[model samples]
Target: MAPGTFSHPNSSSSSFILVGVPTLEAFPICLGILFCSAYVLALVGNSMVLLVIVLDESLRDPLHCFLAMLAAIDVLMVTSIVPKLLGVFWLNSNQIAHTACSVQMFFVHSTTSEESGVLLAMAFDRFVAICHPLRYRMILNRETIARICLAIVVRALLVMVPLTGMVTNLPYCRSLVVPHSYCEHMAVTSLACADPSPSRLYSVSMSSLIVGTDIAFIAVSYGMILRAVLGKESCRRAFSTCGCHICVLMLYYIPGMVSIYMQQFSRGVSVRAQVLLADLYLIVPPMLNPLIYSMRTRRIRKAMLNVLFPRKAHACHGGQ
Candidate 1:
């Protein structure tokens, strides 16, 4: 059992009941369908991205490798929350073991941080390719990329493990009913009998540090890329290359920022609204990432087509 989450001093175990959306409790069927559809789409789309990236030799490069990492993180992110969410909505199985809830909280936070790190890495790749085309390959070689990925994982673990640990260590003698879809950090912390200010302070500071630093670095990278491409004939191609990344960056950061800040700061925001934002933050990106990449990136699109429609791809190639 997680530290102080036991039901009683003599009780062997305890559980947290996940109340998905309190106001929408009467509409579980609708909410369940929506969540199920989104989960299936996210899984299929991100899985296809991973498959195509692995099978297709043309995408053997740093950009697609980062994309594969993002896909894997998205898969983990959605899987960690959605199954339990489904159980809550469909089977009325909202009761999650204390240890399991803590683990879910860790996975959710860690995967999100990893995704942010990968996005920053992707932005740097774009900057190098555009601003220093000749040095791109040498700068972001396989070894360097591998190290960057290792660093991202290490950083996420270092940051989130402690946050989850702090939450788990709190005395949760209050109501164990988490009022949102998942065991969100704040939602779990709210149930703590101890003052949750330390955990909240840690969470906010770490989140701001990660998001703020990544955004600043990405902005600087794009700033340099823009400066390099201005008035050059390659400007169009430069924007084209970075456009998909920018779209994805917006998809990720915007809702996430709103969700985090609103949850922590805004007294006017209702619980249902907060829950909706949190759901979208996790759901929309995973579902849209492959779709956006497939539509905007010709290589990924072609690779996907070749994988999914091999005969058609062969016929089209033969025609060309």
Candidate 2:
């Protein structure tokens, strides 16, 4: 590991340089502005959602509790990657220590897996509330919701711990230049001088297992909910209630699935396009989750309005 020569195996002082959207080198200023704006909006939006959930006791149902948890996770997920990405884009500071890279990968993957679990839990909440209306309270009380959240955290840890271990122990003897914005597991592992096949396979399998299980459960829960809503009126109401959750699921999963497919199969896709898609997978959901919930869910929309216009809310309350 000489100073000038970059080629070295088992180098002691290995650091990864994250190359975030190298194709956008010409318009770094514009891209920085755009990404900064999105990051700020994600932070503010998710924070507001969490704030409203905390303040409004009336909105403290199981659904709202789950939404609050989701918002918090979104905040963490974006915070883990976006600030570093902003630094790469804005300040041109892309070098991350191996330890720091491992930390980023852990948080990013763990939060994502936790999000999937939370969505599945939310679907279960909806299913029980809709399909077993008489026993909904018994099924999904505060204690139950807390337990579900605990399980989500535990599951994410169980899956991510080993994956992180595998990636961190790999002998990164080659150039440590990560060809992406942040420290994604694939992006980081791909740089290893040793064979990365086992790490890659394990990563894909774990992701597929966790996310696939969640998706299957969500589908089953929603299918049951649909079957239970017998009448036209009930069907409409059920759809109205679940619309926000559905939209959030789509926003979270679709881009990620596409990115995975492109990574595996679409060799013809340009690196720039893949990098952009990867950013979208991480950036879009957090920015839009709060917006979709606020716009599509009447209760959240009303709660946000009340928070924003407290005096007006009090006036309306007095009139009522």
Candidate 3:
């Protein structure tokens, strides 16, 4: 259904399969369940994070501003992919229209790049807050946030659009079955009967540039933060403040880096596992980022508890 897929010639034959994927077996049932669970977790968690951050008056700092933006992006990223994935896996609808598929590919890849930029921004925010606390506000003002968000959107769109052009532009002359649940660039491009080497190379090169630069810059920013924090009077307090960021960074970066490697070289692994891991790379953080990251503040915790049980807790406090 998506633009770059190879569809089954006929649904009638048992031998006919969707692209390079095997027809689902019992194991695939587990995979589908896991996929749905991850999606649900991401949607619910990120939604709650955004809700708590926005609704609570106490949580309105510039840092929380960037975090709210991050949560919003994560919500967008997962919601975009998971609905279609659920339709395919749970409802036996594996068709993604070429137009729809191209759009999906564009958003998914763009969000990936956007997240990278946001992480860099967050890291820089932390660096400034820790190192130059007095000037953090002046340095990263409202105008700066708007500019950074705009730049991230433009940069990601520019980088990923070219790859989308390569994918949708190719003359796909056969079955249009998408091997992956979502319209993965590699999975989509591979379906082209025409040579896809140029597209693949371009994708790899661009990804390397985007992801590599993101990690390098984050490392440098955080490295400075680490040095500054270590030399501080209260190392424990400094570490405590950054604990959430650290968890988020690891949750995002490690799985993502591993996924990049797996995508490139994990040939012997099962496709189901690969798909599951890929899905995890997207979903796990969206879930953990909100739950794990937001718990750092007592105010946020109280706010979350209030939201969860406002009347009862309020009555209890009054009675006490």
lDDT of 2 by residue, 24-132 (tens): 7677788888888888989999999999999988888898999999999999998998889888878889899878898999999899899999899999999999889
**What lDDT tens digits, residue by residue, belong to model 3 across residues 1-320?**
44444444554221112221234533545756776787778787777778888898877766777787888889888987887776665666667777777888888878878887888788888888888999988998889888988898899988988888888877665656666768888777666778899988887788788878988988898788778778668677767877887788888778776776676668987776666566778878887787787578666677778889999879978999
Query: Considering lDDT, which of the candidate structures 1 and 3 is the better prediction for this target?
Result: 1
User: How many pairs of residues in model 3 come into backbone collision?
Assistant: 13
For TM-score, the strongest prediction is 1
My TM-score estimates for the predictions, one after another, are 0.97, 0.94, 0.87
Please tell me which predicted candidate would have the highest lDDT against the true structure: 1
Residue runs of model 1 more than 4 Å from their true location after superposition: 1-5, 8-13
Q: Give the TM-score ranking, best first.
A: 1, 2, 3
The local distance difference test score of model 2 is: 0.86
For candidate 3, the TM-score is 0.87
Better of 1 and 3 by TM-score: 1
lDDT of 3: 0.75
Model 1 has a clash total of 0
> What lDDT does candidate 1 reach at residue 260?
94
